[model samples]
Target chain A: MTIADQVTGTPIAGTADTAVRAKTAAPAITLPVVGERELRLDLFRGMALWLIFIDHLPPNLLTWFTIRNYGFSDATEIFIFISGYTAAFVYGRAMLESGFVIATARILRRVWQIYVAHVFLFTIFLAEISYVATRFENPLYTEEMGIMDFLKQPDVTIVQALLLRFRPVNMDVLPLYIVLMLALPLILWLMKWRPDVSLGLSVLLYVVTWQFDLYFSAYPNGFWAFNPLAWQLLFVFGAWCALGGAKRMSRILASPVTMWIAIAYLVASFYVTMTWYVPQLGHFMPKRIEQWMYPIDKTDLDVLRFTHFLALAALTVRFLPRTWPGLRSPWLRPLILCGQHSLEIFCLGVFLAFAGHFILAEVSGGPVMHALISLSGILIMWGMAWLISWYKSEADKSGSKTKNAVSNADMAGGG
Target chain B: MKAKVLLSLILLCGCVAASSARAEDAVPAGPPACEVPAYLLTTESQLPKTAEIIRDNKPLEILVIGSRSTAIPSSEDSSYPARLQAILKEKLPSEPVHVSVEIQSKKTAEEAASGFVKLMEAKKPTLVIWQTGTVDAIRSIDPDEFRSAVTDGVSALQQAGADVVLMNLQYSPRTETMMSVPPYLDNMRVVAQEHEIPLFDRFAIMRQWNDQGQFDLFNPTRGSELAKQVHDCLGRALAQFVIDAAHVGPAQQQN
Candidate 1:
């Protein structure tokens, strides 16, 4: 199997050679295409997923571990960038092999799947909020969740939701993802001819977005929490890197000067973020500096945030090589499993984050309770990932048994 | 075991005495019960326009743009804005200090910000104190959007020739669990810093008060009377904050 197949997390169809190896492999192991896949991507994507889950819940001491506490960017950037990279890596191969028409069809199919997931998540989310609000006599749940419009005018809100204009707090990511995925076919098509110019076009769109203050109007007022126009730059940049940009910059990236520059940028961002928490640090920060740094706009994907994420990625690549043994460690297995099954795990995370928030708000909100809720939420995500992986492997085994008798004979001989 | 208990009691007593002593030091000019920390009351950003107006001995017109928190039910005089006006008038007897409140009830920062140019054109105050973030937080507006709105508002206010002081959300121990507040709070602080203006950290001050047992913020039994006391304390604290940021005290007068 190619690396593309592994990145997409779709195990190859049953063959006699693979069936023999599967039986010989450990009974506990469920991960498909482990050694061939880019473990670094899976590992970091998994870590980002966990961080997103933690950040979604109400703020607690546990939040200090999130990247937002230390830098300008957060898990959202990592998720989007990796998503772009993986999409391009997997589908670019498919496009090359099967031609553009087939690839575009597959992309649309994925977009439809995401759209369905988003609608489902939205429905369940509204139900959860309304149920909690009515059952507990705490109308704040509906209000605080930004579902008040839905509660008041379900008809209009449902249409707006279907149009992807209305979204509750923490529900913004999926809609943004849906839009990005829908645009990917075109992006991939453009990249096929000229990857660098395509990225330049994306950057131009970002600039024009800021210049004209163009954004999609959210329901009741304001704009999208994650502006796709500005954010598409990062996504396209990821795709660019996956195609050939990284290879072109391999020498520059390997240079000591580039590494030090990335390190300096990270340290500077850390210091700036620290000054937000510790006001005394403001004494060292000049007024002009503050003027330049104010409104580090996350919605529009500020340049500082984009650069910060790039710096982080640069450092990550430097340190965590693909051959790093830590990637294959047993401790990181749960995270890897979640990352491998990112879509379902992400949906689960969104649901569990609200549930966690409800428990903390309704029951107790002490430090101990915060710790328990955070740990258990992640444990549940991990458990779901493990179950899905196990089930997929079992299904694969059964399919192999039905399709090929030679594999079954090899499996029986190995057993 | 008896010695250990006696030692612990002595230590506790010493801690109480030390705290009381600190509170006493802070209470000479402020209210006896509302001794805010020096750091909480002070701002690194100075109100230059306000200081200039005070030094010139002109009428100090202060416009308070806020939401529901600016007013009290059935007792307009007990609201923070009213109490602030009273305190400012009492302190600056020579200068005609007028604190007028414009309540933007149930409005987010963006909505309120869009109204600033028109409001400032009419009001024309030397100092504008903006109390926001509660409605935005409750409504779950995007923090980045909220930050940009506040930035635009502060800029508008400054261009209108007013020294702006931003006030963040009120702290309630009960709602603290249900809603997320730090993003709004941090964004406000960033805006205040970026504009080189003082932010009146109402959330931090109130949270400090609750933590110190100065007020039981979680208790519903105290009701409006408790709200009155809290507003009064907030008014007095805000008055002091304005004075310090403007640097209009005896030391500044001598300078």
Candidate 2:
């Protein structure tokens, strides 16, 4: 019944049989029978990370190619969704096998790690911006990146940074992720017991928050850029799908009607985006309709953006199955690697994006310069991912080899 | 020796006279401080109504709808709008060229736009130069909403029988980092293009001046003097832009 059981390619009835057989035939637990890694998740997540890096630095021509220009939702939606799916996939199993307290502790540990990373990034990002600002003798750079407040009051700003109240530009996502991760245990528990009811409660919360205009107040002004109260819906939705929501929706997902609806919505969103660019198309759009859809708020995660993301996901799932051979191709390996080490790559990306912006701003900003910066930034990210992956594998090998050596010594002593 | 000095002085005078005469025959250049790139002043779009008013030798009533920057706080006469009036009067001595300013301080594009219909009915100017986007960028309003508001305002102005010239946000190196401006700037450009109107790229022109070291925008000590100089340059540039858009040169005037 658990995702872990499903991942091992055993039916509900066959799970007990497989466990009994494993106990009798083998001393240790068996490895997963099926490839449950879901390379699609990693590939998409990796692509999203790269896109986020690109989108963070403005005035780049590549931004025209990003999903934000073409559609309502962007890489942020994809990142949050996959994060939820993976969190549920990993922690759900832990909670089922070990216990609730242990699983909660592990989630808390991840939250702490993410919090530390955020603090580290905040410090480094401020230092980089401040150094550039002073070196170039352009205090505008500091003002431009919203570092003027930090300069005015370092002690207060540092405290605010630690509290996740103040963040410079392009450093918002990590804090949001931290808040979401902090709430995972409770979400996972409710999901385990009452999936539908829990999901209903999340939707209700979203609606109530919107109605009451409730949001975490950001430092030196307005609310959080990515309001956790609202964005938690997407994370919870992803987790639900990880549990049994996808299975429940299998029939609807496979239906031709649903496919056509999703396609139609996507086309509508595409047309709306086109109007933003080509104003000639905008004339044809009814004035009343334009008034109704004037401000599609990204901060609160408007319904249009949410549905657009859903439509996109639907089309993606319809086309790309789990068994797609392209998932294992050499071309996609870099993305998968980046996705596996997302936290490190993401932190690196935020730093790199700012660095790229600095290079473009201070130096020449020709098309060729942009090309060089973009390509080099992504290459560095890929290289970091590869390096981390290699180190992790080597560490795993050594860890297992040490265990084996310890056992061998025990055997010799016994003889 | 006195005769030789007199001869040199006469020669210098002759050269100066010849150059001045040539300048009169050619296009009259602006002051050194007001000099901007030709591309910034030139426009493909025409102010047809303004041109018609010039041809008819009618009173060219131009109303400027802008924020606080439109007027200089220290000296009102040194403001861009006032300087524009002075420049226009000098350029068209025969015609009564009146430039009036209406300050819509601390208002976003949407708010300013909502008042256009009523304002147009009252002012009834032949040309309307709308300076906007600074407040909108400061507030971080939705770009789509900003664009729509601009479109609405432009249409309303056009419908009111006024030629519209959009003036985008001011260029300050400090505020550039504090707010995201490209969206609003791009949206303004797109709206101007869509409506087939002229866009006075104030941001670009100011940036050009700053980059060229014509003005020290970073120095706080310059204060009111700096404001006056920048405004004067802007007014001169805007005057040239209007003249070019209207095609009111000697060649066209003779026709």
Report the number of the highest-DockQ candidate: 1
lDDT against the true structure, each candidate? 0.74, 0.72
The residue ranges of model 2 lying beyond 4 angstroms of the native Cα positions read A1-34, A132-150, A400-415, B1-178, B182-255
lDDT of 2 by residue, B17-135 (tens): 22221122122444465556565677778999999999889999999999776776658888899988887777677778899889987787889988998999999999999999877
For residue A28, give model 2's deviation from the true position in Å.
29
Question: What TM-score do all the candidates reach, one by one?
Answer: 0.78, 0.72
Task: List each model's interface RMSD.
Answer: 11.7, 18.0
Q: After superposition, how far is residue A221 of candidate 2 from its true place, in Å?
A: 0.7
DockQ scores of all models, one per candidate: 0.15, 0.06
- Cα error, residue B59 of model 1, in Å, equals 8.0
Tell me candidate 1's interface RMSD: 11.7
Please estimate how well model 2 matches the true structure, expressed as its whole-model Cα lDDT: 0.72
Candidate 1 stretches greater than 4 Å from native? A1-35, A128-150, A399-415, B1-22, B25-37, B48-62, B74-78, B83-99, B107-127, B133-163, B171-191, B206-233, B248-255
lDDT of 2 by residue, A277-383 (tens): 44458778986787577456667788898999998888889899989999989999998888877888899998887777666566654456776898899999999
